[model samples]
Target: MKDMFCFQCEQTAKGTGCEVKGVCGKTAPTAGLQDKLVGATIGLARAVQKTKATEATDVCIKKALFTTVTNVNFDNESLTKMIACVEKKKAELDPSAENYDMAKLWEDNEDIRSLKTLILLGIKGVAAYAHHAEVLGFRDPVVDAFFYKALVAIGSADAGMNDLLPLVLETGTVNLACMGLLDKANTETYGTPVPTEVPLTIEKGPFIIITGHDLRDLHLLLEQTKGKGINIYTHGEMLPAHAYPGLKKYPQLKGNFGTAWQNQQKEFADVPAPILYTTNCIMPVKDSYADRVFTTDVVQYPSMVHIGDEKDFTPVIEKALALGGYKEDKEMTGINGGKKLLTGFGHGTVLGVADKVIEAVKAGDIKHFFLVAGCDGAKPGRNYYTEFVEKTPKDTIVLTLACGKFRFNDLDLGTIGGLPRLMDMGQCNDAYSAIQVAVALADAFKCGVNELPLSMVLSWYEQKAVCILLTLLSLGIKNILLGPSLPAFISPNVLNVLVENYNIGPISTPEADMAKLLS
Candidate 1:
């Protein structure tokens, strides 16, 4: 029998499933445990369907699913504990409930499996956002309710394309609400983001590097590390934390330390200070810096120190002080050799400048808006994003978010009408910002969003991207260009549906795709 089977990410082995192990560095055993974790959560959903879901069940379900997300948790011990938690919660909800065997879905017919996988993976992404929102005391009943509904549909023995297709779109529609919930949680908690420039230089002293997407964790760390002589630098998805008024208030919340998530192994190998991971996109730990890596929230790795729910960052702070950071200020640059990265152009910031942007467009100073956004991976051809942004006409605006912006975020793309040519719109969770900007721009132009001279060229690596794509498609957005590869879990039939319905197409060369998008 195959050791494991996973195709949830864009870089699945050979453009098919990974049977021997996961391309994301998960062992066969870890993969099996993750599948079991998901199975137990499904089982819990089944119980919740029969009985009512309490806040405990809701929290357990979200944590279980979030733990299984790519690069989040690799420890079998933690996975086993999570499974027990799910099972225990299931038992509390309904004593007779049983766990669904994930193997059955894996071996099912391809098309049905594809549709269910879409719902399943899409919810996994939703769970992540919900977890983040819930952390900030923000919860949406609609988003919580959809999780149970989708999970039940996945476990249904007689589920078919007819039964699952609409749910798949509903997954997207619900995800839009979930994203909105997260957006509200973030903005209300931290205040609306404003445009800010983040430096890449690392100041000398005891410091901590925080990666991942959790703003609350960053806020807490920034609070605890205050006046402690420990400077904190954001990494990967945490780079956008600099844009928040709440986070940027801390003087010691120093500059960003690295680029996208995929480069962690090389970028972090010898870094002096401790690195705190608050969410996914963590790679397999290297012996070189493993001792310095600490994780909190759903992010965990074998033998890595995890800051538990109490959220005390004492260990991370101690480690940073112990490491004694750089002896002198260290200079860093992004992929394009630029010294600083600019971010914080969320919906609030973008919309605040709507009149100026509208005038620029009407005056022909801004020709088009290209959203070169989504997750970035280690895969080749990602440079296409950098090249595409480089090739865009001077009058066009390039909006980017998530780690994919690392491909060109450092490039000095001159401004149009006093606004930078390229605007960094926070993290992947901030796709809501892009959508809001699009809809508002469409409203300003008195046109449909699809007719607003905007194009989305997305680079996806994981499930979050999947749900966001579903959200975009659910809104009837069309002609999206996605690459470096389409998802392997999407069967030809489902892909055909997307192609016909949404005009979604795989990306080609930057030159050709840019010409086509412009044309």
Candidate 2:
């Protein structure tokens, strides 16, 4: 049999669909198994769409789709379990229900594949947020309802381009709500994040490196290891945890340990600390620290101990103690050689200073607002984001989120009206905070967001960025620049459709893009 096709991320083979293997190190067998899992999940959704969805239905569907997201789960054994669970759900909901074969969509007309891929990839991103929110005891009915709707639309053979196109944008509408729910969950559980400076040095003794974006897992780990002499350090998207009021109270919660998700292969190799992954951006495990990887929720890799619902960290804690991290204090720094970084300047923080921001704008002290944010990647061109920020004028405020900020996050961009020129707005999920701040600013200025001197220059690396891009488009935001590169799955016709509708284009040089935006 021939290999399966996949192009859901920015790293797809040759900047297009992957045939033999995924660009992110996923093998042909792994890709096929993931496709099978997605097919089974769609079958379960088809079954649940007929019957009223129960809580179990919603949870299972979200987890199933989230698992298929890029770089999330690579273990065929765990995927096999998800497939069986979905089949069982289909049987329970309606024994006669049948799974929609995903190959049909992949092999369909080019235009259909483009539009459906948008909806499919968009929902995969949405499922990640919904799963995060669900674990925090927060759930939105509309957000939950849209998952089934999107899955049904993608699986629908009869749906025309006209149908899938709107559904593609609607995925953004639903994802906005999902992000909102997750923001609420994080705030309510962890308290609002305050502006905080996190150190880059690792103290001597036992420590655990926590990566990905799930705060609940971080919270659980913090609680389980309270007095165990194990230090917890944030890595990747979890870096913002140091700014949350509830989490930062833990004395043993130390500083960050890595630059970005893309550099984990080098950053994590030969590390003394055990790493616990709560969500995505998990690269293939390296032999250097393979024995120390502990995963909970949907993040899975073969042979690594899966932290089940028990959520116990005793095993990870024991590993950290045994390894006895850093014979001496290891001083690390950001890419820019800064010893500290700032985060948690979320919407609540931004809005609290809205009057100062508004006054600065009125006084012409702040000329433009640039949201230079998105997923960071290994691509060479991504240096554009770093240079773009370095080149952004002093009178502008740069807001960033996700792993993309690692490029220039350590550079001291100076302050404007008592606010840092570059503000860290939590994780990718906290794009909700950035949106909130934008809407609030627009309201304060009594102008539409586009008219408020704001521009978004985003870097794309994964499906989460795709959903966030759709959200911005659905809101009628225009002239946005997206790079390191566009998604490989989008056909030229679909690209024309997006460009014609939204005026979004690929990134140019930092100087050229800035000249255009600040002109």
Candidate 3:
């Protein structure tokens, strides 16, 4: 990178390149290390193509991509170590293996760079789902194989729009498979999620705050701390844990502690309990709570106690006990002042009652459906999501996923044909569920998905959201409204291609966007 050009996420500075540092709190050194890691990962993928992808290769690419995701790995030391590992693996596989310098991708013609960015970032999102599923012993060799192909395409010479465009859409196809694999792993392992309300109150006593989207880590922590007097409060994407029967059955899996991930700096500054980070969206840990920050898997911070592959959380448990949390029950409210929020309206739950939802639409009880889902950020225009949901017509049903739902999740938009107006569709990974429901609705209505009364008004923040957007576009889902702002990586021409082919564009005022989308 000339000066560390990164515009992978929604919060890119002024919707342009972040030449100095990332708005998400990443340093130049960290970005360079991530670039090197991606380069090494591409080399490894090339070598794997020559040989064959193993379970280990799948694991390596998954970790490499996950590590490069924004806010996941800020510690340059860890990223450098990851690069070394990828290089070593490449050498073992192909003695002639050479790392692809990221400068080539960064300095490429603008349109090529944009398309390649779409593939790389989209795979990063897929790798996240793959890694999570692998943790639970669900591996799709077909999905795993696509990573190598996509990486090779990204690194290949003479590759341009004609070569890379199909791979770009394939990334979405593979990501859908990855998400389906994860959905199976999650549902089979944790039981399909049900509608459940979680309190925002922090129970009195020693506790552990588990952030990120990994339920396996949360389950392990609950197991280790079962009788240890430490209550486990879900934070960030982990908030949906309360709806899973297996997770909620754990008596110690208490209520949620904080709101979305972006508020962690202030919300966790003086948190009395130890905080365990199992995935990304971690802000630079404030010194006030640094000692209590424990990271695992791909999430790493320098000097934080890292719980490695063994998944032994005893260190975190001991810290929680040592810190001895709040003196009394601390009641917290969401931004809306509502005491509780509901989640677990995934495909299973929604499709289980699809008949009623369809009947309601036919009877005009539900006129339109909006899938307002994506990552939440702390930028100026983020409130567009909340306002969009609030202003949706009374007869419209709003389905949400990811941390962005925190904006207005507590509003209790009432019910339509016995279904809540707003249905929380688990985490961003659960975009798989939204896709399933969309395809099903299109089938039922005997029309294309775009022809259905459903619209996707998405708010994106990171690479995962980037991949999800690509997946939607790849599926030919059109006329989608994207906001906060359009991605910075998309040059004017590339965006024109998308606008002409897909009709995707940034959101305007909530009222205007709603009117346009509903029209």
Best-performing candidate as measured by lDDT: 1
lDDT of 1 by residue, 336-448 (tens): 79999899999999999999999999999999999999999987889888899999999899999988999899999899989999999989989999999999998888899
- The global Cα lDDT (0 to 1) of model 2 is 0.90
Flag regions of model 3 displaced more than 4 Å. none
Rank the models by TM-score, top first: 1, 2, 3
Tens-digit lDDT string for candidate 3 (257-306) = 87899999999988888999999878888899998999999998877888
Give candidate 1 misplaced runs (Cα > 4 Å): none
lDDT of 2 at 186: 91
**In order, what lDDT does every prediction score?**
0.93, 0.90, 0.89
How does candidate 2 fare on TM-score? 0.99
lDDT by residue (tens digit), candidate 2, 324-354: 9999999999998999999989998988888
TM-score of each model, in listed order: 0.99, 0.99, 0.98
Which residue pairs does candidate 3 place in steric collision?
A: none
